[model samples]
Target: MTTVQQSFPVPPQVLWNALPAGVTAIGGQGPFYDAQRGYVTCRTGMTFFSWGQVVTAMVSPAAQGSTITVQTALKFGVFDWGEGKRLGTRFATAVAYAAGTAALT
Candidate 1:
């Protein structure tokens, strides 16, 4: 799995609410939020260079704001050739943009 973690100067709920939009911006599908689990999950579409990936964003409260940890893994392979990390970065950027914090990039 490829993981990307980021901290934002916003409430956990704010970041959590932006997860779906972030996923969609990355060309993900079926973004599902599990409030009880404190996470959002989505799947990437298949393309010529990839088989698809499962992306998960877990949000947690912080002292001042919030922190998000995003994990990306290939649906059917042991190696993703850095695609997972790329997708994770894009997801985080989109979430930051949606949350009105474009400085996260």
Candidate 2:
């Protein structure tokens, strides 16, 4: 498992709207967004080094704007060899871009 969190200078709704695009950027599908619950999940295809991964993003309100915590877990494996971390970072970065806001310091 791996997790990456990013803060953006935008509302939670703005970040939520970018969840789908973020999933796509990481070669995943179906963001399965739950606005009321403030969470999203995606299913990634199998890769050469991985069986597959389930990527989830949790959105929360922040004082500055919003914070998104992206987590990636393998479908079947004890270790992902950094693949999960990479995917989580990719998803978070894509969401920041799609939200039209840079990451907060």
Candidate 3:
């Protein structure tokens, strides 16, 4: 599994609102958010991918704003050929774009 974690100044609710659009931008569907757990899950429509390329976005309180992590695993393979990293980058980019942030780390 590969994970992309980023910190932003937006609150969880704001991030939650941006999630669906962001996920859709990356060919993801059925985004589900758990407020209690601060988790958002979805399935990606990535090519060469079976076994449900799941993406999990986690949000937590941060000193400045909030920290969000989007994690994905490439099933049925030991190596993803950087696909996991690409997925993370895509998700982070969407979120950052929605949040109106200058950039993500």
Instruction: Choose the strongest candidate by TM-score.
Output: 2
* lDDT, model 2: 0.88
Deviation from native of the Cα of residue 54 in model 1, angstroms: 0.6
Q: 1-105 in candidate 1: lDDT tens per residue? A: 999999888998999888877888789888888999899889998866579999999999877688889999888877788888899989988989899985333
Candidate that scores best on lDDT: 2
Q: Which is better, 1 or 2, measured by lDDT? A: 2
Off by over 4 Å in 3: 49-52
Error of 2 at 55 (Å): 0.5
lDDT of 3 by residue, 1-105 (tens): 899888888776777667775687678878887888978888876476455478888877787678878898865667777777788778877877887774434
Candidate 2 residue lDDT tens string, 1-105: 888998988989999888887888998876587878999898898898799999999999999999999989999988898999899888888988888878988
Each model's TM-score? 0.90, 0.94, 0.84
lDDT comparing candidate 1 with the true structure: 0.86
Flag regions of model 2 displaced more than 4 Å.
none
